[model samples]
Target: MSNQDSEPEIDNSDLEGNSRSQSSFGDAIEDQEDELGSSESGEQKSVTSDSSEDEEQNEIIRTGAMIQQSKGRKINKNERITPPFITKYELARVIGTRALQISKNSPIYVDPKDSIDPITIAEQEFNENKIPFIIRRYLPNGNFEDWELQELERLD
Candidate 1:
């Protein structure tokens, strides 16, 4: 027999295996897509329900008087201090700034005692309330209140 007449048989097992894998991969993707679609629909339904409940509560709140009544009558500005006393942060800033001024040969508010240190002198001046400075405290609403150094309540 001639080589042309006696041709070798081709193996298709590898092709069959590849086809099976491709079909399984496609099935997995379809299943995932179906699961995702169902989950998204469930989430949409839950969101709608939650929003409807919120709308009902909002309608009730809108119908009722939502104005908050003040607990106490407003006091005159001169009657009481808003913060009552200077904060530790404010005290530190004042002392540091005054010490800088003292170091620069600025006029000292109080006489230096045993310690001629600028920081010590600034602390003494602060304690004696001799600094003629206004502490401007600002609120979040762009409003500010100015407190005189002597006007603040002292811890000591």
Candidate 2:
């Protein structure tokens, strides 16, 4: 067969059928909106009541009131400096990072042993608490705290 016979047929009837169906669907939607008492202005009515708006405003006001209450409370300079406790995950991360640094020829804070293993050296430094590292703690509420390792020792 020739290339012309091999080519797919372009049917205008299918296109007409689809356009008719889409117009019918649109008309059905317009009829539904009219039955539902939609206005001529075409602006949709608010599904929520005035009470919902009042509740939202009350929530905002309540949060603001809490902030105002907090402002009245006396601030303790000493209490604000309290350090958070270190977690196991943080300890592992610090040790692993330090070990990687040591492997890359970073200066060791602790006495270097005969062994060349970076992990062993890191463990030694951590155990002796000789590494001058800061413990950073993050809370789920986006609050973060940083403290010197000395603070961890003090807390212990």
Best TM-score goes to which candidate? 1
Instruction: Report the poorest 10 consecutive residues by lDDT, candidate 1.
Output: 57-66
Candidate 2, which segments miss by more than 4 Å at Cα? Answer: 1-77, 80-84, 153-156
Put down candidate 2 lDDT per residue, 12-128, tens digits, no spaces. 886765553344554655466676665655677678432233334211101111233323432232544434455556666767877988999988888876978998999888788
Candidate with the greatest lDDT versus the true structure:
1
On the 0 to 100 scale, the lDDT of residue 130 in model 1 is 79
User: Which pairs clash in model 2?
Assistant: none
TM-score for each model: 0.48, 0.44
lDDT of 1 by residue, 1-156 (tens): 898779987799867656543445556555677888999877765333211343342111111122332232323457544676877767777778788888999888687967769999999998887776656554433344556667777765
What TM-score would candidate 2 get against the native? Answer: 0.44
